[model samples]
Target: MSSNRNDLDRARAAWRWRGQQRPDFAVTPGPGQESVWDYPRPPAYVPDSRHVSVYAGDTLLADTHCAMRVLETGSPPTFYLPPESVDMAQLTPSDRRTFCEWKGRAEYFHVTDSSGRRIDNALWRYPDAFDDAAPIAGWFACYPSQLRCFVDGEAVRAQAGGYYGGWITDELVGPFKGEPGTGHW
Candidate 1:
């Protein structure tokens, strides 16, 4: 007799097989492909069926239900989702830029409330990512102070400690791959 584990695996395999047929819109670049001097990135996004993520600071902050992608731009790998996942009224642009070899250049934004509280530049987006990863042209990342993280409507903490801005998922394994490990990976 086969266990439910086999049934689950079959279902997952079927789903994954179906997904590969479609062209991936995300413009994610493979490692070492980025020009550290030029710094432009287009990325390949791994699709997340469980797309709703949020960051709340004692309030109802960002919330959305769509596909999610991880940006590998030599900075911090950030969680990027469709803009519709977040309420536009609560966000604003911030004057911050981080340099990345893989993803090109990045710009940041902050969230605010009706009460006039500022969240600072807790979010970011790559306006024009590099060649391999361009589908995520406008999605943003939430910095540590601006919001807490949640995926698939579940409240989750960043696996990466002290990574206020960078969002962590099953795919983008780090803390050992990059800094904190002194770039050994």
Candidate 2:
């Protein structure tokens, strides 16, 4: 309802505050490494076959062998999993929604465990992605900070700052966008 929308708006405003200097956390990408600074502006979706899994403490919430990774400038890669690979029964639709210029409207989901523990609005998806991002339609992406997210058995560090959901791992180098003073990046 309006309250949820307002909350979502407030959250976005807090995270998207403008002003900054791009920091120097970007490292020279070595063999088998990717520098987030080198990512493209409109973002690019690359099919990823690496196994992806999400857990709420000891409870398995999602597991997938197929995923799509979005690489955007100044941000770590974000992996999107097909809905079939997630435990849809444990997720309830949330009233919150957000707009992504390239991805269209993103609907939020609250994750819950059978025991009733829940993480509010921690997952999201673009039911109708813009043409440039259509590859991710019907896919879901989680905030690693809200749950344990893994790629090929490696736990991913959550991208700092709550607004953008990107997965950070040894394979990537930053100053990523979510950190302090990166609003303008």
Candidate 3:
């Protein structure tokens, strides 16, 4: 592997929280709810059967029951929808890209509505995801901050920071990583 790749591996290994124990600051989950602190370090791809939908104003962008939720320690779940369930025609490939240690490289997309309103880098996908993240390859995940998102008929809230794509619903509890003073987490 290249030096850069080795450096990335080291960085990924340096995380303090690996989900073995929840910190005191983390909220205790209520009945029927989950704590993000209990999620694993490398993350888990859990198949979600709940209704998931995304919209830009009146234009429906994606709707699906087959979403893969990536649950990682200290962060809320990021839901990825199947390609067939998303309206690809409204998505234009963007030049932006990012890398995740467990998921590999991600390419972004810009969403355009019927009324010509465009949200740049609103969605992303891992075309050649690492083996552990292969289940979500070619699937799409949008930023709830940029577009309206819902799960099981409940309006989704965007994760605290502008960076994370986690869709927060009522069933999940967190002192989520993206919040202020969580940079080290």
Candidate 4:
């Protein structure tokens, strides 16, 4: 109980530092678009049936029709695919781990292609997700900038900062939070 309270306090402090208001420069959603600012806090995990694909240059690493997307306020969506759809041969477990107050501990993976080129800590997964984030258990998500990603046949662009692994697409409009000076979204 005390640990949970401490965790909640830390999360609240982080959010306070990141501010709560949407920036004025944030794009207004037009037809068929989503403004990231409209997303929910604590994030939402929802099923996405779109065909999602990942590639390391020309090597196809993952392709799946079943995926989950995490939508959080001020950030672009991060899509996660089931492990079965991914080429497990291409991934090597990394010692890196990160914590999320809403989820739990996240483990990272290093991706490598057939050509032997490697992207360190390019993938992440919450092996032990919190009850509310259980939907993402056993799923994996990658950094679009490290490996090419496509959603419904459209190529994805990586969100600005190296820390956040959100994939930016035409349907997502933003003056996104991961960019410079947005530490206080």
Q: Provide the lowest-lDDT 10-residue window in model 4.
A: 12-21
Clash pairs, candidate 4, are: none
Q: For this target, which candidate reaches the highest lDDT against the unseen true structure?
A: 3
TM-score of each: 0.60, 0.85, 0.96, 0.91
Candidate 4 positional error at 71, Å? 0.2
TM-score of 1: 0.60
When sorted by lDDT, best at the front, the candidate numbers are 3, 4, 2, 1
* Angstrom error at residue 15, model 4: 1.8
A best-first ranking of the candidates according to their TM-score comes to 3, 4, 2, 1
Q: Is candidate 1 or candidate 4 better by TM-score?
A: 4
lDDT of 2 by residue, 62-81 (tens): 99889999988788999999
Per-model C-alpha RMSD: 15.6, 5.5, 1.6, 2.6
The local distance difference test score of each candidate is: 0.52, 0.83, 0.91, 0.86
- TM-score quality measure for candidate 4: 0.91
Model 2 lDDT, residue 169, Cα: 92
Model 2 residue 164 lDDT score: 93
Model 4 agreement with the true structure over 25-83: per-residue lDDT tens digits = 77788999998887877788989999999998789999999999999888889999999
What TM-score does candidate 3 reach?
A: 0.96
Top-TM-score structure, candidate number? 3
